[model samples]
Target: TKSLSSNFIKNIVVEDLASGKVKEIVTRFPPEPNGYLHIGHAKSICLNFELADEFKGRTNLRFDDTNPVKEDVEYVESIKQDVAWLGFEWDGLFFASDYFGEMYDRAVLLIRKGLAYVDDQTPDQIRETRGTLTSPGQDSPHRNRSVDENLDLFARMKAGEFSDGEKVLRAKIDMASPNVNLRDPIIYRVLHAHHHNTGDAWCIYPMYTYAHPLEDAIEGVTHSICTLEFEDQRPFYDWVVRECEMPATPRQYEFARLNLTNTVMSKRKLKLLVDENVVDGWDDPRMPTISGLRRKGYTPDSIRAFCREIGVTRSFGIVDERMLEHFIREDLKLKALRTMAVVQPLKVVITNYPEGQTEWLDAENNSENPDMGHRQIPFSREIYIEQDDFMDNPPPKYFRLFPGNEVRLKHAYFIKCEEVVKDADGNVIELRCTYDPETKSGSGFTGRKVKGTIHWVDASNAVPAKFRLYEPLITEEAEEEGQSFLDHINPNSLQVLDGFVEPAMKEANGGDKFQFFRHGYFNVDPKDSTSDAPVFNRIVSLKSSFEV
Candidate 1:
């Protein structure tokens, strides 16, 4: 795991610890259990956990599952898995539901203190009276309810006396407050839904804005860090904690959330895609969810390193997506086994080579990593090469195979194309070539030279496999006017093709990563791949124009 990068948060943490302001640092990764955690969340995960670890502190993995209507246990479990997969061990496992009783008591105390009341206004009415940025909000008629009356109504609301949306518990803050968030925001709402955790124990559920602060303070989180969108809500967060008379006070801090090009970070939109089956599921290789990135062959090391390099800042900008791809390549460069895979195969028959004999040729596993050692590849009379590596009519600088063209076979002898075997309709199906055994690889022969070297799989012992090539699910980084995000979905986001790999890959287990000779880095599919027919997802291509 990479060390947490220095940022404003780290500096604040350092100052707090040095001045004896905080004896022990405590942080929390609070995720709403509504959908799968995405790469955007990964940034926050790294920040919270690594920050606490750096100071010899503790971080809690907290589920902010206040909205039962949208939250689920599946999401809660997924979040836990994603955090652990990212290499973090939470010091405490908590849920907002754990403090539901305390939150209700706090609301009751607010009612007794005349700091909160039950607002009977409809949802639309409340929204309308909340006024826009340029205007002051109008006060509700019930805003002046006596503390005794509010207590009775709130108790009834909690006892299921009212249907959903009949009455809402609103803080009796400023009605004409310039900061609209403080304009008597609703602290609790009546929602008649079964909670995944609590399960219909109460009809009145506390709003996230109210429950979040109390939860942080209850757990003694020294610094309440959150994304910038919540920055404006910081005052309200403070108001809740202070008015509730929590024993501990936690300061709120905000940093910019992650935004990446050609990626969607919103959970609402991600859940929509899953519901509509636009992709396979939340873990589809194309989605930006942490599980999706995992299924797509991205290593935690690469992701953690990427998060560290990005740094924590309040600046808002879209990070180049290529920068992410660059880190994955660096992470897997010398580690992944380099092998040969013929994605679109063309049969090549060595006419002059021995007919029924196969020989084991030594092939370097990784040219750049000598410690990886070498593996023997089978060579025989027939092999399968990529269909794109040949052309009937050569371009000006085409150095690959063509009629009568000589090219070196990787880790083998030189071969000259003697004849092209095609179907009646003029589709080139096969090539008849003759190998020059004198130019065998590792022979140190310098008599002849060839500009092109191509990788091939032995036809007799090749493993039949499928390769899935992926592209950005979103075609356009920015949605144009008059189009929804769905309209910008790429039509060709995923393409599957039959391929052949060396016999050694026949036993390749799911999640195993390898670098195909000239194709790209690929990961075996964990869910669908079997020994009979292995499936590989192309992680990335061999060459890229992106640089760190």
Candidate 2:
């Protein structure tokens, strides 16, 4: 395993160990089972798992499944797959719901100590009284109920005596606290909704903020790392742990979340896309979800390298999406097999070549790495070149195929276009070319040279395939908090084309990657492709101007 670079979190772990304030380090990747994990979550997963791993400490994969309304077993399984795919093995697998019994006891302890009380206010009334940044919140009407009454009400609320949102348990902290989260934040809410984990075992669920610190404490987590939005909630986090009298005190550290330009990082927005059928599903190649990236042919190594390169910082910034493209290109350049595939085929007839015969031409798998060796590609009297490779009306510097223009066929002989066959509408449909035997590739023929060398596949033995090209699903950026994200949807995000690969490509299994000549690196579509009909998803282009 590669050594992780020193960052602020790593530095803190080092200091904590050296100072003897902590014996052994423990971190947790706590994701709520609401939706499929996104690329942004990848950052956190790397941070938590790798940080503890670097110091030979423990890390846990915990699902904070408090809100039953959005939690699902599907999300839980997807998260487990994503974490494992990222190359992490958690020391412990846990769920916040696993500690529901203990959490309920803690809430009772708070009530008996007069630190928490059951508030019989509506969610709207609580929000209305939750004063602005410049003001202080008003006290709940039931905040001063006798401890005996609160204990009874809280027990009844747990026993299913209350309807959803009819009553909530709130900490009796200062209502005028400058930090809004410390202003008597709700600890428990009566929700009769069925939970994916607990099922009907719980009619009252603890809010995430209230359960998060407790879960960390119960698991002996030394550092509770989270996004910067929780920076304000740190006070309340400590309050719950301290007031609940937990044995272990876990400190929360906030880091800036990843924000990519021209992409939606929010899970809620991503779910909306899936719900509205804007894309295929959670694993649509165009999506920012980790599964989507995986299905789009991204290697785990590339993503991990990217997360490391971005580093751990508390400063907010928007990363250019091209930077992500750059890493995938780097990862696949020498490794991916460079092969010939015509995405948009235009048939060509070799008039002077022998008919009813096929020639296998030698081609290197990767020019940058000779150890990858070479493969023989079929060439014949009839071949398919890209439609864009030929031009009926050529521009001034156009060096590709045209009437009377000779261009070298990649790995084959030099061919000159002699005629362009057209249909009734005058649209060029085919080309008739003549090849010079003396100019056969690797034949030591230096008598002639062509400015253009274009890739082609033998039509007689071509492997039919489907290609899916993807762009950012969101074309522009807007405030997603208010549903303006829909305004930036990119209509041209996905383009599907029927293509043809070399005959040998027909044997490629799903998830196999290849660098098609003149096309981008593509992955065999794992979900839709079959042995007879392969589908390729373009992962990234061959090159980009973006640099590290």
Candidate 3:
């Protein structure tokens, strides 16, 4: 229940409240349900909902489903789930299609007032005539159609008497204006496709540029927040509400959209990644989509905290991806259960210990948070340690399991490597070691000290697990001029390993997260994990050099 930090958008709301320019502020998170919501959308979601909540105002969750070609019920439901998972409940749920009737009435009013007309020009022709930044646009030949004729054609177009793309209704704004968006923008178009919400109720649909403003007005939205790319369209947004004489006028504000280093933020590009199987699906942990992050073990609190730390601003820049990783590590450090998992196991035999002997050693669940209590771990004659922990011939300052070197087994006793056992291929397959009973962890023994401490699981009770290590999904630098973003797809983004964890973790349910001692934080994959065999996705490494 933390309050949002101050930002430009918050400042605007404060001034509006003090001056009584608005009685009660109303905000909304309106997403076009064309694809899955990504991390970039999380920033907007937190902004609108948290801002409204902080002000004791109401926020609505609305869908701008104007284009039936791309929108679907699946995207709508997924959006709702993402919002809820992020810890917000909207005051009202609505869709733009809910006001199609009123939108048609507004369009008719535009035509009647000589502010709009039906154009027979093709989409390509309209685009060519829109003009450049320094050049003035040419007026359409059909711009001066009679109001009665325009209304009649529009009605007929809605009645399905005309084919798709045959004609469109455009606002009669200044064609010679410097802002190209005001140069007679299309407000309505003929789309014969069936809508997911409205079914076949109407053949004609309003354009997003037109529907967005009216939807805001209809919902009594005091401030329409959007990304910086829509700054130019603000002029048209205001013009529509003013010229159409909407009872409620909503003002639009623009803020910088999120851009992350080594990742593409475009939904179009993400959809392509999904369609082409570049990823397993939208929920692939390597993806930046909200579902992907959730499946990868990111907590809602971490994401919300991250969004707040970034703050809101009009300036644009790419955030270092490490900053995000830093937040997750901070969020999970004290909360995740501390345990040992050998991702690449190398068998170590305590050569002098009695055979068939297993001792349960005490280990702290979370040393930083003692309230989490402690658990017992099995230590036995045969154990599995990381294969990387041992070396036949190590360099100077090498502290781990080299022959004749001593190291402490975490929560157990100090052990010295006596011999190395290798396969015929000359690969070290196992190690023979000796443990000193006097050097057991927490035994208050000052006999000696070792420079290294490594974690291991008793081979007798070790549960087989699958550990997935992840790297950046996009390996190359940000896209260069004329290069496709897909060209940078990291071939080694995911490295799966067959490993073993403590027996206590066998019953860990899906979504349960843990810290694998020095390995890192990991989560049970909700989609692929089963009760019998658990699969862990490495959420992040135990430590990072990334500073705030």
> How well is each residue in 381-412 modelled by candidate 1, as lDDT tens digits?
99999999999999988999999899999999
For model 3, residues 125-202, the per-residue Cα lDDT tens digits are 999999999898888999999999999999999999889899999999999888899999999999999899999998
lDDT of 3: 0.92
Check candidate 1 and list the clashing pairs. Answer: none
RMSD per prediction, one decimal? 1.4, 1.7, 1.4
Q: Write the per-residue lDDT of candidate 2 for residues 394-510, one digit (tens) a residue.
A: 998899999999999988999999999999999889999999989989999999678999999999999899999988888778766666778788888999999899999888998
- After TM-score superposition, what is the CA distance of residue 271 in candidate 3 from its true location, in Å? 1.0
Model 2 scores a C-alpha lDDT of: 0.92
User: Which is the better candidate, 1 or 3, if ranked by lDDT?
Assistant: 1
TM-score (C-alpha) between model 3 and the true structure: 0.98
Can you give the lDDT of residue 251 in candidate 1?
A: 89
Off by over 4 Å in 2: 1-6, 479-483
TM-score of each: 0.98, 0.97, 0.98
Best by lDDT: 1
Give one clash count per candidate, in the order shown. 0, 0, 0
